[model samples]
Target: MRAPCERSERHRSVARRRWISRASWACLMAACLGGAAPPFVSSVSFAQQPGARQAPPPAVVVEKIEVQQVSNPAQFTGRVEAIEAVDIRARVTGFLHSVDFKDGQAVKAGDTLFEIEPDQLNALVASARAQVARADATRISAERSLARNRDLLARRTVSQATVDEVQAAFDVASADVQVAQAALDTAELNLSYAHITAPISGSIGRATFTTGNLVGPDSGSLARIVSLDTVRVAFAVTEGLLVTIRQQQASGGGLDPNTLKLSLRLANGTDYGTPGRIEFIENEIDPQTGTVAARAVFPNPRHILLPGQFVTLYVQEKDAPSLPVVPQTAVLQDREGRFVYLLGKDNIVSQQRIHTGARVGNGWAVTKGLDGGEQVVVEGIQRLAQGMTVQPSQGQPVGGGT
Candidate 1:
């Protein structure tokens, strides 16, 4: 044998040459057809290949612009007020013998609220009656003397001067009797004032003066009474809103105080089930707040509404015109103003600039840049690009409950 090792080496050399020739042939064939693809093909090129799977368009939730005839209510922080409020005060100077009503009690007109010590008043009345009796006796004696003097003068037993003097005495006694009667009347009237009574029908506040406390007319206020059957709320509105109201009223539009729908939301975020009507609007705008004051009246049968309670007041114009509304989620903001992504035909998304106004429920009242029946993208607006293709689905109703 020539050598086993030499024979094995020759076979390896033959295989390497055969493999090189085959690689060159393949490269030449790829160059003749087109440029050779890289060893690692990019995803972009793979997608461009015929029969390759295509990625679906981005999905978005869209809603049709609703032309709602609902009122675009404006809300403001309001303070509750009593339709009629009164400060209770003592009318007579006296020591309080008893407080008839408890704190925060409901009282009616003519209800006795407090009792004053009446011993001194009773003594004054007795003294006045005694004075009246003494004056009456003096008048009777003077009248008898005047009559006797007149008869004597007629019978020539008395002079005209003596009769005239007796007449003057009778006149003085009569005047004294009248003055005493007036004093007695005054005493009785004061006695009535000792029993303090409520002047209105409403809920009463806590008494400032308890029993044994001296109270008088000069004492500021003993307690307060607020009407519970009906209450009022006062709030401020911007000058622009006030002007619009005035214009509507002047033109006899439907925005008059009588036509407004007033509603209240308590501090605890509960609605005051009963509706209210506008009571009055202030005469002028406040210079400091740049707003005008307005008031509304609501029925408070349960006495839930109280004076000075902070609450939210919503005012809406009845029968307001229809407006295009978009869900709050669909709106986006930039330096120019507010805007929303609108879905046009061919499933294309377009950036639509809009002017927004007051909030209507869970959406914004579209003041401009949109009409009814336009499709607006609510969800998936974050990643959406202008003119991008998207797959749309019906969106959930705005303001709907879960």
Candidate 2:
């Protein structure tokens, strides 16, 4: 056996020779198999080199520009109201005698609602009539005395002062009759007021004062009545839009009070079929809210629109102007700002920042950044980098129904 150092050198030399022989065999096999040997050799090579990484492409959908009709109707929140609403209050102070109408019942103008006890008024009227009868008897006696005095004055049997006294007595009796007649009229008026009557045709609300309850002229409202044959919807127009409204009115290009068309949607999302016209707009804008009050009248024949009901108002006008719009999916947000991917002629995606306005259906009105004819990537933006080349397909959006 050799020394220890000599033994180590002999083992290294044998290992090198073995590696050389294995490499030569591999080279010969690769030459024979040519292209077929690469996969197998690559597998062997991959085993030696570890930690290789693979990246995936982003998946998305897209859309193109198409011409369409766009409407920019003024939008506002409003409330349904009766054309006229009045609170029923007692005209004279007295105990309520009887209630004539049921709660929530439809009423007509001059319909009796509540009957107050008119016993005192009736007594007063009867007393006034008696006084009138007494005055009539006294006047007859004075008239007979006056005629005798006039005859004696004509015959020079009495002085002028005596005739004047008799005439004055007759005049006093006639004046008393007029006074009593006025008193009777007052009593009659009071009795009529005792019967609470509706001032306007409407539907009566729950009674605040019932039978035997004391009510007075100065008392707060006893009940409420709202006329629903025609209803008004009150809404506010923002100060920003006020200028546009005025401009439209001044141009005489859009609907005026007579020609304007209006519609309403109920709280439950049902549309009021009868279209309305703008009745009036307030002269001044509200200083507190910076909005102008506008009223539109709708025919409520069936009394469907009730007072105090919340409603959404849609004031329809002629077509506005056309605006550029893109699918909502195309819009993307990041820390920088809102953006979308634009596909170039080479099927590459480029980042584009956009300024948007009102949303029309499922698309946004692009005010800035994108123009007509620019293809925006509605889908597949996530799969792309700023400069990465991508395969683009005209992605059809799922649903965009009106």
- Model 2 clash pairs are 58-383, 60-379, 60-380, 61-378, 61-379, 61-380, 62-378, 62-379
| lDDT (C-alpha) at residue 339 in model 1 | 88
| Candidate 1 lDDT by residue in tens digits, 79-108 | 988878899888889999999999989899
For every model shown, what is its TM-score relative to the native structure? 0.72, 0.68
User: lDDT value for candidate 2?
Assistant: 0.81
> Candidate 2 — worst ten consecutive residues by lDDT sum?
393-402
Backbone-clash count (model 1): 0
Q: Per-residue lDDT for 378 in model 1?
A: 96
Whole-model Cα lDDT of every candidate shown, in order: 0.87, 0.81
